[model samples]
Target: MATDLVRAFVREDLKKSDVVAEVVSLVTVLEQEDFRKLLQEFVDGIDQSMLLDVHLLNGLVQLIRNAPQGYIDVDDLVKILGLLNTRLKDTHKQSTRHTYQLALTISQVLDSMVDSQVKGLSREQLHEPLSDYLEELKQDQDPYLVYQATYAY
Candidate 1:
């Protein structure tokens, strides 16, 4: 049932982008085995490239960061983080506001994971892109961006 629902969401033109987060929410309170299968099905069914968009990637990252203990498997979580890293590679060209949003999202996710007992990407893995974001943020003249980066850094 979860697999079918996930597939349906992926097929829906308007809802496809929301699939990652919805799946995360659905499986949060489920058993580990169930969570693993649902997440594996989701990962296997979606095109990896679709996650390269920052909006979708943000949803996935935030979901993993905020989800409960059984919501996503380590392998799937790693794959999502990898996608985010790939998408964020050239983010320096984006506006400060955009960079700040991305950095803040990643930072909040990292912070949430610390507060939760859920397991997913290691701190080392998330910090790589964050470090880059902080470096980029350092060059921005906007005090808001600087403040956010400093707080997140």
Candidate 2:
């Protein structure tokens, strides 16, 4: 019941927020070691096959994108980068797109805090796991994602 847990977690009074402030609060939870176990539990609670769907992946990217600057702690980075590495290594095109969008958002953090990690990155140099995600977005079906690619330039 990974979906169930994700649903419960997402529906928690904790997950509902469009503003960056609320998102930062969520990121704080991710910074805690307990959050890793919770996330694995949440994923394990779901049907493994559902991992193929881009919706869940999309939601994850959205979550990271919504995080506030300087709040992306190492634990949070571990979760985000690990997922991106796994999805991209498998050559999941659409899944990679979601990651790219996440990078684009982070790169635009006004202060460019994520820039050194994300720019012109190779798969091996993915300090932030930047390859497949950025590549897919740079050449995406969505214009906004495309626009987002150049925004870094």
Candidate 3:
């Protein structure tokens, strides 16, 4: 029921972030299994097409940021990180303001994941890709991207 509502809300022409946040807050009160299911649904629903839309991206980021520890598994994190990495690479080539925004957003997501101390998330899983991404960012001509990369480091 809640998942259906969330889907409906997201499909609407005028999506409301507050509504989505409220739904997430409600889901967090559910039993652990149900909460995990919702998180899985949100993560699985993400796609490359959604990356360019800031509203949709923000919604997804909020969901991940608010998720309880242990609910977001290794595979889910890998998927999210992979998508962000791909988008970051593509956006960097374009060299638009959106690239910096995305970099900051991705940095926040990474920070949240690390700060949350997600269960079973090993340093090996996070370090290599993040290191590579940051290194790439440091080489970019965009001062914002370089600053973000340095700050993230």
| Model 3 / residue 86 / CA error / Å | 0.9
Model 2 C-alpha lDDT per residue in residues 103-129, reported as the tens digit of each score: 443344322335326443333655434
Error of 3 at 22 (Å): 5.9
Instruction: For candidate 1, write residues 72-148 as lDDT tens digits.
Output: 54555446445445445555645665666655655665455455534644567665665766777767788877776
The residue pairs found clashing in candidate 3 are none
User: In model 3, where do residues sit more than 4 Å from their true spots?
Assistant: 1-4, 10-46, 92-94, 116-130, 139-143
Instruction: Please report how far candidate 2 places residue 108 from its true position, in Å.
Output: 9.3
> How big is the positional error of residue 114 in model 2, measured in Å on the Cα after superposition?
4.1
Question: What are the runs in model 2 whose C-alpha is more than 4 Å off?
Answer: 1-36, 42-50, 58-75, 89-125, 132-136, 148-153
Return the TM-score for candidate 2, rounded to 2 decimals: 0.40
Model 1 poorest ten-residue lDDT run: 43-52
Arranged by TM-score with the best first, the candidates are 3, 1, 2
| Candidate 1 off by > 4 Å | 1-3, 13-54, 73-79, 112-133
In model 3, the Cα lDDT at residue 75 comes to: 67
Q: Please give the lDDT score for candidate 3.
A: 0.64
Better of 1 and 3 by lDDT: 3
**Which structure is stronger by TM-score: 1 or 3?**
3
Query: Which 10-residue window in model 3 sums to the lowest lDDT?
Result: 41-50
